[model samples]
Target: MTEAEYIKEAKKGSSAAQKWLFDELSGRMLMVCRRYVRNEQDAEELMLDGFCKFYSSLSGLQYQGSAALFSWVKRIMINECLMFLRKKHTFVIVSEHVAETLALQEDILDNLSAAEIFNLVIQLPAGYRTVFNLYVIEGMNHGEIAALLGISEGTSKSQLSKAKSLLQKMLLQQNIEYGKRKTQQ
Candidate 1:
């Protein structure tokens, strides 16, 4: 069935359509949750929560296209992750001065694979990881991120800067370690 048909049936409480939709989108949605949350079980739970919200609100959603459906679901998943983070009070806002002191080498990211980069991003402290995911991956501006996270725009920027710097350092360290291993082999 087409996505529109599936959405329409799912909205009308068709269990088969709902299952199909869940099967189709769950993996991508779980990955989105995992990006914001470090814990595997937590990410899976948040993804399920996001799907529950999406299904409950399906009647209100205007069926656009597959892209719109994907985007809407992704937004739901992101919001769920953000809410979880907020409840944990995990956003550790460092002073802008301290974040500014770290210099990011842009070229370091170019050498890493997408999976490698994602692993590095998840390793960041909660504040830095959240801002980095919002600004870089989600293409949100600092102001939008600040409003969503209830932080200042400067703080959002600082967190992103610090996240980048830390990623660069991690990438460099990985490269150095790889070189050492290569030489010893």
Candidate 2:
């Protein structure tokens, strides 16, 4: 059945259709949750919660296309992760004066796989990770992020700047380590 069919049936309380949708989207949604949350178990739990919310709200969703469906589900998953982070009081925003932005070498990024980049992002602290994900990955502006996270725009910008600086340093260190290993071999 097409996605539209599944969504229509799922909305009508079809358990089989719901199961199919869950199986189709769970992996991607889980990864979305993982971007904001570092803990494996917590990410999984948030993903499940996101799915439950999505299923419950299926009645009101207008199924535009597969892309729209995925985007809506992804947004739900991101919200769940953000709420979890907020409840933990994990956003440690530093002052704007101390914010340092570093230029990341495009060449270095070009050499790394998506998974490698994701791993590097996952290593960032909670505040940096949340702001970075919101601005970079989710394509949200500083103002939107600030409003969503209940922080000032300056704080949002600072977090993103710090995230980038830290990522650049980590990338450089990884390159240096790789060069050393290659020389030894």
What digit string (tens of lDDT, one per residue) describes model 1 on residues 1-185? 79999999999999999999999999989889999999999999999999999999999999999999999999999999999999999999987887764667656667778788789999999999999999988999999999999999989988998898888788778889999999999
Decoy 2 TM-score against native = 0.96
For each candidate, the alpha-carbon lDDT, in order, equals 0.92, 0.92
lDDT at 183, model 1: 100
Q: Each candidate: how many clashes?
A: 0, 0
Model 1 per-residue lDDT at 3: 91
- Which stretches in model 1 have alpha-carbon errors above 4 Å? 101-111
Residue lDDT tens for model 2, 107-185:
7756788789789999999999999999987899999999999999999999999998999999889989999999999
Clashes of 2: 0
Model 2, 71: alpha-carbon shift in Å? Answer: 0.6
Measured against the true structure, the TM-scores of the candidates, in listed sequence, are 0.94, 0.96
